[model samples]
Target: MEIPLSHFEEYIDEPLLKRGLSYFKNGFVHEPEEIRPGDYEAVVEGSEDYTVKLSIRNRVITEHSCDCPYDMGAVCEHVAAVIFYLEQEELGLTQNTKKGSIKKAKASSSKPSKRKTLAQQVDDLLGKATHDELILFVRELAAKDSLFRDLLLASFAQYNPNESKTLYTKQVKTLIKVARGKYGFLDSSGAEYVSNELSSMLGLANHYIRKGNHKSAFFICTAIMDELISALEYADDMDGHLTDTIYDAFDTLATIAQEDPPEEVRKLIFKYCLTSFSKRSFSGWDWHLNFLHLAAYMLSTDSEMEELFKRIAAIPKSSEYEVKKAQEIQYDVLLKRKGESVAQRYLEQNIDNPSFRARAIQDALDQKDYEKATALANEGIEQDSGYPGLVASWYDWLLKIAESQNDTERIILYARYLLLKSHNPKRDYYQILKEIVPPEEWTNLVEAIVQEAMERKPYYRTDLVASIFIREEWWSRLLDLVKKEYTLDQLAKYEKLLAQHFPSELADLYAERIIRYVENHVGRSHYRTACKYIRKMIKLGAREKADEVISQLRQTHYRKKALMEELDNV
Candidate 1:
């Protein structure tokens, strides 16, 4: 509530905000209207038009929604552009110079009116351009930019699929070459760039799909998947964007296959999937499993399905991990093809495996057979006796089923076990218990968890204990926990929590950390780090203490010129 214009930076990522601001200034945001008291809507033109809606309460942007396929879980550029527009309007800094011509409002005093934006100028010029002139301009522009040419061709390919098939394939090859760097390595950024380019091709393929050019779409999707998969060896796609893009391409091919494409197209996709799966290099990767799944989906005949399973069974299981993965893939394919009864029988044969047991429990839950689900989960937990992590997962599954059924008693029972006995307990367990248990009982439960953490030898997970103390505002206890020797980094981690609730203690902790930092190291970087802590100490109202520590360190380390130089700089 009551958000100021400056507060926009707080809600949006800096890069996105900058892009949005550029969009606003370039007049990409159009027709922003306050639809209600504190709600605004606008259209932002990017590759396509996107609708942005914002809800303001008091002066703060309380909610933002944008119908753009941006998946970063933050306000998209469209939303940010609309906010920038609203901010400009609020500041009396926007005006329409002519019909449908937006420009920033200028000062009234004698200065010539601000020039129209480049976009505005472009629109005006384009409106005045003759048809032949526009075509000549585009032709010259496309000639100068290969990407422009490729995109133009791709767009045309959607309409004339047969004529542009070779062009589309060439573009895919060019993209792969560009994505794979000179040294045959695509780093994270390279992978991201490649993925984005592949997505553009996907968009074109989808356009073809929409136009009933399934053959062209299938070819494009397969080409993308094949090229991207080859590039995988040359790229460090740790973020998995490139792989995900390829998966999307595979999914597209699956869609085309399912649509009963021509026999030739179906055979092509099937061969690609099966050939990719057969590669030893692709074995044991998630893509390998997905390829099998896709192949299973594309199998149109009983003989094909039987051959698919046979191929999977024939794959060399060099390790138990590979064996398990192959089994899991087989089970998934079986489940998709056969009914639950048949899948259940297959699952029972592999039930000794913890994973299969988990799958069995999930299957029971999916069927809404709560009793069977509960029995299977308990049996899995019992059978996986020595694996605490597996047992914890089973308990989590049970807790989820209980929550689904709203069985509060069972939830409490499972949550208590999870909180106490699970190898890696989640904060959700604490939260669920808090919501269900009586407020009077909540404190005792938290205290017990914290006390158990404290009693563990060599101080186990003090962060968890500290979290509880911070959450409950048990500042004194939190201070006690941090009173021991801690590195500057450790103290910094809790600095804000302590500063807000225990300023005096935090100041003291900073003073202690500052002294330790100076005493331990004599290098320039170390001295700089120590000076940083000293400044933080001073900022926390420990000026006298910080001064004393710095003076002592300066006098003690006076012979070290580099350290003294850093101190002098500080």
Candidate 2:
């Protein structure tokens, strides 16, 4: 939510706003520091003190983030409290209001003593208790609380003789089940909770790995991967929290593979990888083939290599990415078992794979085989014409080769072409042309580039031409481009950039667009948005123009009560 600092209460939930206001008046919001212009950081004292950071631009809260455990809504009370504290004057709130509210809240409370967090209270109690008392307390809680008992058992499982993967697996499954909602689905919050809990388990695995207890770590990692992989089916996972947990599990496993563990541990992981891959356990995911990548890292015997090759061959060519991965894996296998010469041959045989082509191109470049590199890159450009990003990369390689050979003609040709058309442009190709082209012809070249950009579809090349105008300090031309469109979005985007040079012109354009916007759109939300621009017009030194826009809107939209009400806010 882009919070407009002018009337933030209208944008946030009323209940949330009230809570935030209470928090602000109670002095929970610490003094916010302007870390830099338009950027603020404040610590709001709460259950656990949370840090809130806000980005204010043009008197609007453009972005905000809080490091608190409140994910159910976009704006947490901590963030709101910080916003209120920052915008007190704009909100017509004064220090006396905060003082009076604090006094009122304190007078109404039965107990006004300062609050301590639950962890603080627990620590206070723990510090007073004896060792024997702590032991007795744990025994009593574990005896009555099944959840506590499982946690206790799992936390200390390293000391128990019967500690096994099953124990941790059951613990993780319980977490998933408990986090599920009435619909048997894990919402975003539920998924986040599960991810954090499983991440804790992975942390334990990481501790064991660092301590060289590979077996214990292996049990924990595999247990998580085994259970949570399936739980993802019913999870909303909108934030990819659940998916990240799975990646963390594999990362732990990768650590074990990297460490030269005991044969028992190595073989255990090797077998798990092969079995999981064969069962298509992680199918429909790119990580589906990651099992093969992991097994390749630990290949030990001829039998293992043959079996891995067979599995790689069995992967269906379902997508271009999958096919590329499979061929790359095959090349890696050949490189490992056969040699670079054999791998090079295999790479050439499967040059359709972009990864293989890139490797081959790099290898050619490394050996100073410019002709071979050029041929390979051009072939890739032709083959991957549909993939503009890939073609851009190939052009980048050609540019590199041209630079290597000091081929001026090809450099300008490729650089100019890339500046005009490469979808995945690497850097300032125009700058490269500027430096390389003779100064006498630079202006002409720029004009040619601008004309090329302007000839494309109106919407397609606006950004391209605008980039040229900005780079060349063609502010008038850039303003003209915005005038060609005169859209609210483009006006807002370029207003700040153009305001200093052409304030009156930009203001008039804004007034015109704001009227068109209101004429075409209805409702108070749109009215608020339109008024937001009216404020921009005022800021651009167009007070008269802004007033005219407002008067026209009021006269034209007098019948819309909501519009009239929102305009009054402006």
Candidate 3:
């Protein structure tokens, strides 16, 4: 086995570093006072033609110097050798004893004998030792035994053996020594382990999926997954460190099913991820996130699975099934098996839960139950005062409900409630009301008046805005309003319509109006739309203007920075 600094450190005092350096360069005086109890100096040899001195102080080798002709580099292999020798022989520090038969014999054996030649030593260091031994011998050099260290590292090189043959050179040896200490952390072993297992399991499952072996692959993968669930009981969740090899083993076993991983494999995924099957018997590894996802995506082909999981993971862990990340993992099961109505009711039942409440409100509105949607929105308002949009949404619905029933006073009451309670009265609620409710109830059409007063707004952004503009019959006024709000973002989105086919001049202006409104944040989601515009500017060769416009736009630095980075990538 090659000797590492760590392993060497175990055998010798760390102070030997200084001695090892000196020993590599020149021979040192030999003092066998302890070995003989009379002589006080020992002569050590070096690679270069020189003898070295070693002054021992406080049981430590100190004050070493080499005399090699070209030895400006100081500490050489001769010094390193002397230190290594003392360490391997387990020499005592400042403790001299009676000469034993071994030392007396060694002294006689050492006297003027022909030692092993440099060429023979070099050959032996390379062609024969174990990896551990080879590593050790390299470290023994001032250069340490670097020759063979390079060979072990060649295993990771990308080329085939014929083209770029990876021989175990001393350079490879040195690199492996350094890499194990530092770079091993970057190997992504966790991810690789999971991917490989999945690949294998997928192969087996494919045999079944192909021969219709999905059942065989399915059963095998499912069995392995079950075992993993049991082992993960003793795992770390928050920290992601898996201490149990069985978890790693089981995880690998589960991935082997990726070839024909059945739906059942996907269902048991949460058992490994969320709930511990045993107790905290292991550390959590970052591996689970990527593998479980790969398995689920393979099973479901849901491109949005990863994105939905990202959103779900951010929610508080304590949320109900409708609100939890585990729910997102099993989203297909919930949506496909039970249908949207059932899903909505599940979320609605947990409306008291902060996590599920928002989902319930959206689901109710999406299902078009105006009364149910209105009631959920009202409930959201009482719990979170700042979420005033909830109350306004209900008001918007109520105004229409009243207008449809010809309850004019009720329409007036909803409108007045909206006008009073909303924090942003200048936008949103009025924006919604200006389009949906009848003008008879609005009288002077104050909702239309308020919406038109915005300094900049997108024409096509909210369907409500366009409906209101069309109803008001202010077509020329819309054209004038759009021109005043045009920004560089409009250049491409408009130019494309004309370039791709043909459109009215009014359509181009409509594009500009939408672009400018989006840039200026006329709506809640309008921020950071410069990306769309910046892309077009470059494509149309408006490079100089594109740069200037994006630079001047009132947006985040990241928006501009991201645009530039995307340019470089392209």
lDDT score at residue 233, model 3, on the 0-100 scale:
48
The residue-by-residue lDDT of candidate 3 on 255-301, one tens digit each, is 54554445664554434343321222222443434343443444443
Write model 2 residue lDDT over 229-315, tens digit each, in one string.
898888777679988888889988999999998898988888888899888889877567888888888888879888888887777
Candidate lDDT scores, in order, read 0.74, 0.82, 0.44
lDDT of 2 at 302: 75
What global local distance difference test value does model 1 have? 0.74
- Per the 3 Å backbone cut-off, how many clashing residue pairs does candidate 3 have? 78
A best-first ranking of the candidates according to their lDDT comes to 2, 1, 3
Which ten residues in a row are the worst by lDDT in model 3? 32-41
Best by lDDT: 2
Give the C-alpha lDDT of model 2. Answer: 0.82
lDDT of 3 at 545: 54
Check candidate 2 and list the clashing pairs: none
Task: Candidate 1: give the clashing pairs.
Answer: 2-59, 3-59, 3-60
Model 1 per-residue lDDT at 395: 91
Off-target runs (Cα >4 Å) in candidate 2 are 1-162, 181-183, 187-196, 239-241, 284-286, 366-368, 457-459, 522-525, 559-562
